[model samples]
Target: MKRLSFFVLSIVFGTLGLSFVSWSCNKKETNTIVSRELSSKKTYLYEDVPFDSTKVASFFVKYPKLLTFQKSIVALYKNRQYHYAWFDKKGVNEAAEMLYNKMSTVQEEGIQKNFPYKTDLDVIFQNSKTYLSPNLDAELLLSSLYFFYAKNVLTGVDEEATKKIGWYLPRKKLSYVSYLDSIIAKPELLAKDDKVVLGQYYKLKEILKKYRLSEQKGGWNPIRVAPDFKSIKPGDSSQTVSDIRTRLFATNDIASDNKSKVYDTDLVKGVVKYKKRNGFKEDEVITQKHIDEMNVPVGERIKTIIVNMERCRWISEEFLQDSEYIVVNIPSFKLTYVKNNRPEFKCNVVVGAMMTKTVIFSGKMSYIVFSPYWNLPTSIINKDVKPGMKKNKNYLVQHNMEWNNGNVRQKPGPNNSLGRVKFIFPNSNNIYLHDTPSKSLFNEESRAFSHGCIRVGKPKELAYAILKDDKNWPTDKIDAAMNKTVETTYSLKRKIPVIIGYFTAWVDDEGTINFYKDIYERDNRLSSILVEEE
Candidate 1:
């Protein structure tokens, strides 16, 4: 691979700028006096060697910054344990050590915890003459992380669903990690006299520079006071109105004895509204939720967006240009499907409740079963099943539940726990999309109500839209499979990709971020990781 010019590398990093990982912990004052290996470090010409051998070991000793850089890489792997990155047992421990070493180096430099160990993106770009760009580094890092993340996660995969994954043909190749090698090796960006290359790099630098970190607000915080008179609605308490409006109109310097200057009604309303929006009782008082949002100050919202912009950098860069896909915004409880290149449909889909927050991931629709039989997950079976089984083994028969070998499954019917239909894309995680009979729960504003499976709204419409492209197929075909007592499966002619993502702030068609509440708390969790990477 040729050396990637600074210009080209910058552009690539800008688009996917947020680097990887760490945890959201309070920043401890880095006063812990840990002993550093006093032997001075030295850097040599870059050489590819077996991972974790002398070459990598030497690199760490030579450039401590490389350690910081490696810490960021390790973070990517650690997060993968939670996401779907693949690795084996030995790989997992090795990667963990790499991250730990890097973190130690940063700690020696008085770097704070919670903040990611920072490396200058430009420094690595310049190092391409000797060392490869981070693009290559990222490829290696992702590879290691993928191996470990996948390995660790697979240990926890449901035994029943494990067999189903290989059945779905692996059509889509994972490309981004491999692609980095080709991208960083491109020389056009590296040509020293190429002003255009430099200009492109600068432009991308400006773009990445725009990404500010999201505000790391936690616990109860302070509040601010703002008064607006026009917000007074009908049925106002005259005394309340008089007192509040007086404050709005009151002189800032007034030490005068005004007996009845009430609270800033609008500010209080902002508080009440904030409280109402969050999972809290809306009492319009200057309570915690209101105080936090109010104290955030409008000036900081842009900073919040900037931080979110950095977040885009944290995702895989090789995105799908064409596919039918569904994205459920947990904060919004809304689902969107994009066909070709435009959003063709949207619906309000319910997600897992607070205790069982919906995990964000990406997947594809492999098969949709009509009048689907629900295989009760072991976790639920242990919690909800045995109780019902013990209380009434008849509960299983009454609900058409049956045991296949050791796996407990429900027979397809109106009363089955899974409601009527299910959309399955075999993943290592065993999570799926399905329709639920608990329709009334959807009406709730804070609808995080499922155990794990995504409960789609108007699943019949989804089924039809997915199948409409097929020739001569009608509802009767579906009816043919469902009417009979046997469990039936129908694979679609075209598979739809489904991405369960976590973006507290994301760009719309206009490229403006439509900020949503961080329902899964992923933003803060990942935000600290991003900070740690830096």
Candidate 2:
């Protein structure tokens, strides 16, 4: 495509907070640019004028902190044949101003630190008239800043860095050089396109704005609970109710705060909303635990949202767009089966406890096993079975376990830890979803009692949902298969992608943001990495 004419480019830049000044290049410079452009095979989209190639090396010397982006910067200019991407014969282009504006409000995107050389950027844009013609320093600075924004806001930490921090789900890799081409063609998308970043990032950003606004307003006061009471039941009159009302209203959980001491209907509605938003049991009763959750400072909540936003960057928008898939957010203790870009069902789940934390990863679920034998891992055998066998001769028989080929395997039964079914998505971590005999564990708001695999509270329902379209597996056959003493396995015709992820803050379907406890204490570490990068 031909480069946007200077008149059209001027209008675009003027709209992005930078007035364009038409520059009069000497006849000699114009001829040189045309000769270079004609010799090159690629079409120009941003500017035809090329900058000095050696200055890119000097750019790193002048702004060494942005040296990390040197590779991407070099590739971008090379792709454009060393053209002046952020400038033209008119002045600094629209894409440059858009990037500058994005960096200026970087914190709004959950970034905590300013971009390196932001002051230098500010001076150049502030004095755009002085640099109306192609300037090497401004050109390279914009290129470096684009990569910085792309790294922190678009792609997040590198895959190795994420794996070091315990995130193993596939990271989305993008060609920032190609992305710059598209952004230069249509600069408005840099500010408004949801596809550029994960849709979840934008949703979390909306919540981040409200929370930051709440922080600015001094936040809500902690709801004080009475020492004598375990929970404030409905219709109970107390000051705690009044405080909760104020707190809920402050967070927009309720429409308004009447500030009444009585546990009225409005206050009860707000209580359930607050509980639901905080990944607690949706109930009218207000307990000390709920009070403690409410007492968590808004600043800490903001940090959690910011931390999860970084996680969103590690994800691909296209991954979530798959026709069918399953995702389990460990911190939220919930699993969602999505089909056609909508959640088919969301069920409570028990993830691995703090000791044997479930790994965050992705796999393709290919099989379903009913009345599955639980082949105890070596760790479990060493930790529990060997000691139990030493303590009692009948331990294996009592637990309905047997030695099968030098491995301890629990027989298919109601009391089996695998319950009556298991969904297998082969991974190196050996983590999969399965039914559990400990159904009561799901009753607790914090359900992290498993060893390392996920225990689905509604495995049968999940099976039904997965096989609803299939003609071969009827409900009666599925039920019979689970009740049979012999283990039965069925391979799915179409393997579903399964992603086991961790997010402490998520925006729900109703547009309300939810905050769950950092079950594995991951938020602080991730937040530190982001700040350290800054």
Candidate No. with top lDDT? 2
Q: Model 2, residue 37: what's the lDDT?
A: 14
Write the residue-wise lDDT of candidate 1 on 70-132 in tens digits: 544445434322221212221222232343344333322212332222243233323434332
Candidate 2 vs. true structure, TM-score: 0.88
lDDT of each: 0.43, 0.77
Model 1 CA lDDT for position 504: 43
**Model 2: per-residue Cα lDDT at residue 50:** 74
Q: Tell me how far the alpha carbon of residue 79 in candidate 1 is from the true structure, in angstroms, after superposition.
A: 32
What clash pairs does model 2 have? none
Residue 179 in model 2: shift from native, Å? 0.8
Candidate 1, superposed: residue stretches over 4 Å from native: 1-295, 298-303, 378-393, 475-486, 510-513
Best by TM-score: 2
